[model samples]
Target: MSTVLEILHIARFGLAGVFLLGGGFFVLAGAIGVLRLPDFYTRLHAAGVTDTMGSTLILLGLMLIAGFTLLSVKLALVGLFLFLTSPTATHAVANAAHKAKLKPLLGTYRQTRKGDNEGGSQ
Candidate 1:
Protein backbone atom coordinates (compact mmCIF):
# COMPACT_ATOMS: atom_id res chain seq x y z
CA MET A 1 0.00 0.00 0.00
CA SER A 2 2.76 2.39 0.96
CA THR A 3 4.67 1.57 -2.21
CA VAL A 4 1.62 2.20 -4.33
CA LEU A 5 1.07 5.55 -2.68
CA GLU A 6 4.70 6.46 -3.22
CA ILE A 7 4.49 5.61 -6.91
CA LEU A 8 1.39 7.70 -7.35
CA HIS A 9 3.04 10.61 -5.62
CA ILE A 10 6.11 10.40 -7.82
CA ALA A 11 4.03 10.04 -10.97
CA ARG A 12 1.94 13.07 -10.12
CA PHE A 13 4.96 15.26 -9.52
CA GLY A 14 6.74 14.05 -12.64
CA LEU A 15 3.74 14.60 -14.87
CA ALA A 16 3.07 18.02 -13.36
CA GLY A 17 6.67 19.05 -13.96
CA VAL A 18 6.50 17.94 -17.56
CA PHE A 19 3.32 19.89 -18.17
CA LEU A 20 4.76 23.02 -16.56
CA LEU A 21 7.92 22.77 -18.65
CA GLY A 22 5.94 22.35 -21.84
CA GLY A 23 3.81 25.35 -20.98
CA GLY A 24 6.92 27.39 -20.34
CA PHE A 25 8.27 26.47 -23.75
CA PHE A 26 5.04 27.54 -25.40
CA VAL A 27 5.28 30.90 -23.67
CA LEU A 28 8.90 31.29 -24.72
CA ALA A 29 8.11 30.51 -28.35
CA GLY A 30 5.25 33.01 -28.30
CA ALA A 31 7.55 35.68 -26.93
CA ILE A 32 10.14 34.95 -29.59
CA GLY A 33 7.54 35.03 -32.35
CA VAL A 34 6.22 38.34 -31.13
CA LEU A 35 9.72 39.79 -31.18
CA ARG A 36 10.73 38.35 -34.56
CA LEU A 37 7.55 39.10 -36.44
CA PRO A 38 6.70 42.60 -37.56
CA ASP A 39 3.26 44.28 -37.55
CA PHE A 40 0.45 44.38 -35.05
CA TYR A 41 -1.63 41.45 -36.30
CA THR A 42 1.30 39.06 -36.27
CA ARG A 43 2.27 40.09 -32.78
CA LEU A 44 -1.33 39.63 -31.71
CA HIS A 45 -1.27 36.13 -33.10
CA ALA A 46 1.77 35.26 -31.05
CA ALA A 47 0.31 36.68 -27.89
CA GLY A 48 -3.04 34.97 -28.40
CA VAL A 49 -1.62 31.56 -29.13
CA THR A 50 0.66 31.70 -26.14
CA ASP A 51 -1.91 33.10 -23.77
CA THR A 52 -4.45 30.41 -24.57
CA MET A 53 -2.32 27.28 -24.80
CA GLY A 54 0.41 28.19 -22.36
CA SER A 55 -1.97 29.24 -19.65
CA THR A 56 -4.10 26.14 -20.10
CA LEU A 57 -1.18 23.79 -19.73
CA ILE A 58 0.31 25.72 -16.85
CA LEU A 59 -2.97 25.82 -15.00
CA LEU A 60 -3.56 22.13 -15.58
CA GLY A 61 -0.15 21.34 -14.17
CA LEU A 62 -0.85 23.52 -11.19
CA MET A 63 -4.14 21.78 -10.60
CA LEU A 64 -2.38 18.45 -10.61
CA ILE A 65 0.13 19.76 -8.14
CA ALA A 66 -2.63 21.06 -5.94
CA GLY A 67 -4.60 17.83 -6.04
CA PHE A 68 -8.15 17.50 -4.69
CA THR A 69 -8.49 20.60 -2.64
CA LEU A 70 -9.92 24.09 -2.60
CA LEU A 71 -6.82 25.30 -4.36
CA SER A 72 -7.45 22.86 -7.19
CA VAL A 73 -11.02 24.07 -7.43
CA LYS A 74 -9.83 27.62 -7.57
CA LEU A 75 -7.34 26.74 -10.25
CA ALA A 76 -10.04 25.09 -12.31
CA LEU A 77 -12.26 28.12 -11.98
CA VAL A 78 -9.41 30.34 -13.02
CA GLY A 79 -8.78 28.14 -16.02
CA LEU A 80 -12.41 28.32 -17.02
CA PHE A 81 -12.37 32.06 -16.68
CA LEU A 82 -9.31 32.35 -18.83
CA PHE A 83 -10.69 29.97 -21.41
CA LEU A 84 -13.73 32.15 -21.71
CA THR A 85 -11.86 35.43 -21.66
CA SER A 86 -8.62 35.02 -23.61
CA PRO A 87 -10.09 34.62 -27.05
CA THR A 88 -12.65 37.33 -26.46
CA ALA A 89 -9.98 39.74 -25.35
CA THR A 90 -7.84 38.87 -28.34
CA HIS A 91 -10.71 39.44 -30.70
CA ALA A 92 -11.56 42.73 -29.07
CA VAL A 93 -8.01 43.99 -29.40
CA ALA A 94 -7.74 42.84 -32.98
CA ASN A 95 -11.06 44.43 -33.90
CA ALA A 96 -10.04 47.70 -32.31
CA ALA A 97 -6.78 47.63 -34.24
CA HIS A 98 -8.65 46.96 -37.44
CA LYS A 99 -11.03 49.82 -36.79
CA ALA A 100 -7.98 51.97 -36.14
CA LYS A 101 -6.71 51.02 -39.64
CA LEU A 102 -4.02 48.48 -38.78
CA LYS A 103 -3.11 45.97 -41.45
CA PRO A 104 -1.70 42.48 -41.36
CA LEU A 105 1.48 41.29 -43.09
CA LEU A 106 0.24 40.77 -46.61
CA GLY A 107 3.63 40.02 -48.21
CA THR A 108 3.01 42.25 -51.19
CA TYR A 109 5.31 44.99 -52.44
CA ARG A 110 5.02 47.73 -55.02
CA GLN A 111 7.16 47.50 -58.15
CA THR A 112 10.14 49.82 -58.13
CA ARG A 113 10.67 52.44 -60.83
CA LYS A 114 13.84 50.68 -61.96
CA GLY A 115 11.76 47.67 -62.94
CA ASP A 116 9.10 49.80 -64.68
CA ASN A 117 11.02 49.82 -67.95
CA GLU A 118 11.07 46.03 -68.12
CA GLY A 119 7.32 45.89 -68.82
CA GLY A 120 7.49 48.12 -71.97
CA SER A 121 8.06 51.41 -70.06
CA GLN A 122 5.09 52.33 -67.94
Candidate 2:
Protein backbone atom coordinates (compact mmCIF):
# COMPACT_ATOMS: atom_id res chain seq x y z
CA MET A 1 0.00 0.00 0.00
CA SER A 2 2.77 2.41 0.88
CA THR A 3 4.66 1.46 -2.29
CA VAL A 4 1.55 2.12 -4.36
CA LEU A 5 1.13 5.57 -2.87
CA GLU A 6 4.76 6.36 -3.60
CA ILE A 7 4.38 5.22 -7.20
CA LEU A 8 1.28 7.30 -7.68
CA HIS A 9 3.06 10.39 -6.43
CA ILE A 10 5.94 9.71 -8.81
CA ALA A 11 3.57 9.25 -11.71
CA ARG A 12 1.84 12.52 -10.94
CA PHE A 13 5.15 14.34 -10.86
CA GLY A 14 6.22 12.79 -14.16
CA LEU A 15 2.96 13.68 -15.85
CA ALA A 16 3.17 17.20 -14.55
CA GLY A 17 6.69 17.53 -15.91
CA VAL A 18 5.64 16.26 -19.33
CA PHE A 19 2.71 18.66 -19.50
CA LEU A 20 4.88 21.60 -18.53
CA LEU A 21 7.53 20.71 -21.11
CA GLY A 22 5.03 20.21 -23.92
CA GLY A 23 3.38 23.51 -23.07
CA GLY A 24 6.71 25.25 -23.11
CA PHE A 25 7.45 23.93 -26.62
CA PHE A 26 4.07 25.08 -27.89
CA VAL A 27 4.80 28.54 -26.52
CA LEU A 28 8.19 28.56 -28.15
CA ALA A 29 6.77 27.58 -31.53
CA GLY A 30 4.04 30.20 -31.27
CA ALA A 31 6.60 32.88 -30.49
CA ILE A 32 8.61 31.89 -33.53
CA GLY A 33 5.53 31.98 -35.73
CA VAL A 34 4.70 35.49 -34.59
CA LEU A 35 8.19 36.69 -35.37
CA ARG A 36 8.58 34.96 -38.75
CA LEU A 37 5.16 35.26 -40.38
CA PRO A 38 4.38 37.95 -42.94
CA ASP A 39 1.39 40.38 -43.09
CA PHE A 40 -1.01 41.49 -40.37
CA TYR A 41 -3.49 38.67 -40.83
CA THR A 42 -0.82 35.98 -40.73
CA ARG A 43 0.86 37.57 -37.76
CA LEU A 44 -2.43 37.79 -35.94
CA HIS A 45 -3.10 34.15 -36.73
CA ALA A 46 0.26 33.24 -35.26
CA ALA A 47 -0.39 35.35 -32.19
CA GLY A 48 -3.82 33.79 -31.73
CA VAL A 49 -2.34 30.30 -31.91
CA THR A 50 0.23 31.30 -29.36
CA ASP A 51 -2.34 32.88 -27.10
CA THR A 52 -4.66 29.88 -27.19
CA MET A 53 -2.33 26.87 -27.11
CA GLY A 54 0.45 28.57 -25.20
CA SER A 55 -1.65 29.74 -22.29
CA THR A 56 -3.69 26.56 -22.16
CA LEU A 57 -0.59 24.36 -21.87
CA ILE A 58 1.13 26.61 -19.31
CA LEU A 59 -2.00 26.77 -17.19
CA LEU A 60 -2.53 23.02 -17.46
CA GLY A 61 1.04 22.49 -16.27
CA LEU A 62 0.50 24.80 -13.33
CA MET A 63 -2.69 22.96 -12.44
CA LEU A 64 -0.97 19.61 -12.60
CA ILE A 65 1.92 20.70 -10.44
CA ALA A 66 -0.49 22.25 -7.97
CA GLY A 67 -2.45 19.08 -7.28
CA PHE A 68 -5.73 19.38 -5.37
CA THR A 69 -5.55 22.74 -3.69
CA LEU A 70 -6.77 26.33 -3.78
CA LEU A 71 -3.97 27.10 -6.21
CA SER A 72 -5.21 24.45 -8.61
CA VAL A 73 -8.74 25.82 -8.30
CA LYS A 74 -7.53 29.30 -9.11
CA LEU A 75 -5.55 28.01 -12.07
CA ALA A 76 -8.64 26.23 -13.35
CA LEU A 77 -10.57 29.48 -13.22
CA VAL A 78 -7.86 31.32 -15.08
CA GLY A 79 -7.70 28.60 -17.72
CA LEU A 80 -11.43 28.89 -18.27
CA PHE A 81 -11.13 32.63 -18.64
CA LEU A 82 -8.32 32.30 -21.17
CA PHE A 83 -10.25 29.77 -23.24
CA LEU A 84 -13.25 32.08 -23.41
CA THR A 85 -11.35 35.29 -24.11
CA SER A 86 -8.73 34.18 -26.63
CA PRO A 87 -11.15 33.34 -29.46
CA THR A 88 -13.36 36.33 -28.74
CA ALA A 89 -10.40 38.66 -28.88
CA THR A 90 -9.18 37.11 -32.12
CA HIS A 91 -12.61 37.49 -33.69
CA ALA A 92 -12.85 41.11 -32.56
CA VAL A 93 -9.52 41.92 -34.17
CA ALA A 94 -10.52 40.21 -37.41
CA ASN A 95 -13.77 42.18 -37.50
CA ALA A 96 -11.87 45.39 -37.01
CA ALA A 97 -9.60 44.50 -39.92
CA HIS A 98 -12.59 43.78 -42.11
CA LYS A 99 -14.14 47.14 -41.23
CA ALA A 100 -10.89 48.83 -42.21
CA LYS A 101 -11.05 47.25 -45.72
CA LEU A 102 -7.74 45.50 -45.45
CA LYS A 103 -7.34 42.88 -48.15
CA PRO A 104 -5.94 39.47 -47.31
CA LEU A 105 -2.97 38.27 -49.33
CA LEU A 106 -3.88 36.03 -52.23
CA GLY A 107 -1.96 32.96 -53.34
CA THR A 108 -0.96 32.36 -56.97
CA TYR A 109 -2.11 29.17 -58.65
CA ARG A 110 -0.45 27.05 -61.38
CA GLN A 111 -1.45 24.00 -63.36
CA THR A 112 0.60 20.79 -63.12
CA ARG A 113 -0.46 19.33 -66.45
CA LYS A 114 0.83 20.70 -69.79
CA GLY A 115 -2.60 20.16 -71.44
CA ASP A 116 -4.32 22.29 -68.78
CA ASN A 117 -2.48 25.44 -69.88
CA GLU A 118 -4.57 25.61 -73.10
CA GLY A 119 -7.75 26.01 -71.07
CA GLY A 120 -6.25 28.73 -68.87
CA SER A 121 -5.55 32.38 -69.76
CA GLN A 122 -2.72 32.88 -72.25
Backbone clashes, each candidate: 0, 0
lDDT of each: 0.81, 0.76
Tens-digit per-residue lDDT, 50-97, candidate 1 = 888899889989999999999999999998988888889999998987
lDDT of 1: 0.81
- Candidate number of the best lDDT: 1
* Backbone-clash count (model 1): 0
Per-prediction TM-score to the true structure, in the order listed: 0.83, 0.81
In terms of TM-score, which candidate is strongest? 1
Instruction: Give all candidate RMSDs, comma-separated.
Output: 6.7, 7.2
Alpha-carbon lDDT of model 2: 0.76
Q: Candidate 2 lDDT, tens digit per residue, 8-119?
A: 9888888878878888888888788889864557778888766777788778878878889999999989888888988898889888887777665445323323344333
Clashing pairs in 2: none
Range of the 10 consecutive residues with the lowest summed lDDT in candidate 1? 113-122
